[model samples]
Structures are given as structure tokens and as C-alpha cells.
Target: MAQESSSVLARPFSALTLQQAWRKTNENPEITKADVALERSPRQEADIFVGNLIDERHGGPITIGYGRYARGQSLTEAMAVDDVMIVLEERLSVSTEAGTVSAGPGEIVYMPKGETVTIRSHEEGAFTAYVTYPPERPAHL
Candidate 1:
């Protein structure tokens, strides 16, 4: 779901409430610290991940959702698509080959596709809303 896929509701365009999106994906378990860090299979959560939002597969495609990382949880990944994460609560840090960026509630951070990055939460951990792009699913997702 987050890694990528053909965009849904993009061609005709539609409006959906976050509540609706949650309803669509809720039957599935929310991604936890281990699912993302060790498993490298966030897309597995997509069994119930129903539909992409407003964009094309390669033309700025993105999927949206939220997840939580326990305090001290961390992971390094080779990104499969562009990731836009908004810290909903607490703080999160993303470190890449270039440098590192950190943010707290209301702040947003971006991690590009095809790069290796390390993600960690602050002592309080983090909860985030994310938009991931490219519409093409990846095994590592």
C-alpha cells in the first residue's frame, strides 16, 4: 500500500474523509516498529489497504496512512518510493547518506525513493501520517 501501486480514485477524482480511509484499511493490523524495521514488508498491511488516492502511478502516485514506533525503535531501509511523513505526535528522525532531519508534531519530512535511510524515534517515540509514492509495489515495502 505505502510502497506503491496503480492509483485508485485518481482518474475520476474523488473525495474521501480520513475516517473513510481508516475504515478501508482498518481490518488490517497497523504497522508496528518491527514490521517496518525488521520485516521490510509494510505492504503486507495492504491486504486491507484498499485504493490509492489522487495521483497517477508514475505521475506522483501516493498512498496515505499512519503508524506508530515505540520509543527507541529504529530501522535503516533502502527506500522503494518517495516517502512524505508528517509527525502527528512525539518526534521522529530520518538519517540518510547526506545528513539527518528530525521533526515533531505538525512537522513533515521527506525521504526520496532509492536511497538508504535510517529512521528513529525520539525518547517519546513517534506517530505519523505518511504519503508514499510511485505506484509500483516493491518487495522491500
Candidate 2:
């Protein structure tokens, strides 16, 4: 009988096995309660956390900070900006020249430049997408 090889066989890179390939998809961003930090703004109380910030310039001044805010009071009161999109949860109201109305989850509220609006907490709090589109381009621009 031929002597059998006692050593372990070497497997190719393509022969590697995956433990599991499937996973449940979560829609909302993974924000732990412990990770939340409460902040006080003139508008309302905000639980702020840095999500993602994007620099829109080549070492210039245009930058976007993707942050999370949980406002329990009138947080964004009449603070004018360019635009915003609600990512996860619903909000109570968004003020505009036309009128204020209820915004649902995943709603995109586009407030143009100089559009005055106030946000009051109808429920306990709100999860929103904070956008920083300044009125005038920065001097570096």
C-alpha cells in the first residue's frame, strides 16, 4: 500500500468558506442611546451626534456635516437654510412661505435660501437630516 500523506492539505484562496452570507438589513442608522449627546440650541433641545461629514471642495470651504439631531422642543426655529432631507423618522412641522405642515418619515423638505421656518416637537422628539448649505459661498471659494 502506498504511504498516505499525513499532513493537512493546502486549500486554494478560492476554496475558502464563508460562515454566513445572509444578514438582516436595518433601514435606520445604528444610533445607540448611549451614543447620543444632548445639546441646547436657541430653537430647541437637541441630541446631537456626528454621523458623516463631507468636504465638497478641493481643500476649499464648502463642507457638509451629516449629523443626527433629536429635538424634544422647538429645535429648528425659523433657522433659514438651503435644503434638508429627513432620513429615518417623521417630524411635526416645517415652516415655509406657503404654510407649515406635518412631514412623514423619509420626507425631503427643501427650504430655499432665506426660507424662514420653525420646527416644534409634536411628538416626544424627531430624527432629522441636518444640512449646512450656507447662503453665500465661502471666501475660500
Candidate 3:
């Protein structure tokens, strides 16, 4: 996985098991409200916990991962990258100055680049799989 991630190698190892992927993230549930308070990144604090189960940020054009947000947590910030989030559990809401939208399990939400928006979890919290473009940020950022 490390080799493929760093060099963009096409080693499509499809034999990976679900358990391995879960273990990669230590099967973590959430990042806890206490931890969220301790964190300072406005862009992702409300995202709770994120896992790079199949990290593609080393050199790939896009990266994949999963994230969990505890109930009532929210993040409002200008997006630094484009994101496509697929809801895996519960519900999610993305709000912009223009309006707001909500999606439930099995639904998808997309937030474009440079847009300032608020993302939050609903009553039951949220779990999602996501893809982000331009895997690595420019150094000046």
C-alpha cells in the first residue's frame, strides 16, 4: 500500500480483506468531543475521526479515506480541496451561504474547491467514505 501510494504505482492489489482495512484504522469510532475541542483545524475538526485506509496522498492525483463525525459536530470553512463524500451511516448536512442540503446513508455529497461551507452530522452521527482531489497541497498553503 505504501509503495502504491507514494509512486502512483498501478499495483492493483484486490485481495485486501475488509478486516485488514478496518485494522488499518484500528476500528476507531469517533474522535471524541474532547479531542475535537483540543484540535484547531477549522477545516476538519468536526469531521471527528478520519482514516487513510488506502492512502493515496503520497503522489496520486486523488486520495481515498473514511471519516466519522459525532452527533452535532460541525465544521465551517473554505474548502482547500474538492471533496466527494459517500455517506456510509447516519446522516450528513452541508450548508453554504446560498442554502443547505442533507443526505442520508448511501447518499453522496460533494463540496467544491474554495467554497466556504458548513458540514455537520445529524442526530445519529455520521460515517462516510470520501475522495479528495489534488492529494497533496502546494507547499505555500
Taking every candidate in turn, the Cα RMSD to the unseen true structure, in Å, is 10.8, 20.1, 10.7
Q: How many clashing pairs per prediction, in order?
A: 2, 2, 0
- Residue 72 error for model 3, in Å? 0.9
TM-score of 1: 0.56
Candidate 2 global lDDT: 0.40
Candidate rank order under lDDT: 3, 1, 2
Off by over 4 Å in 1: 1-61, 136-141
Off by over 4 Å in 3: 1-47, 56-58, 136-141
Better of 1 and 2 by TM-score: 1
Segments in model 2 whose C-alpha atoms lie over 4 Å from true places: 1-52, 55-72, 76-80, 135-141
Residue 58, model 3: Cα distance from true site in angstroms: 4.4
Task: Arrange candidates, best TM-score first.
Answer: 3, 1, 2
Q: Model 1, 38-112: lDDT tens per residue?
A: 322353331111223323433554565455677877777687788776665677777766666667765667777
**Judged by lDDT relative to the true structure, which candidate is superior, 1 or 2?**
1
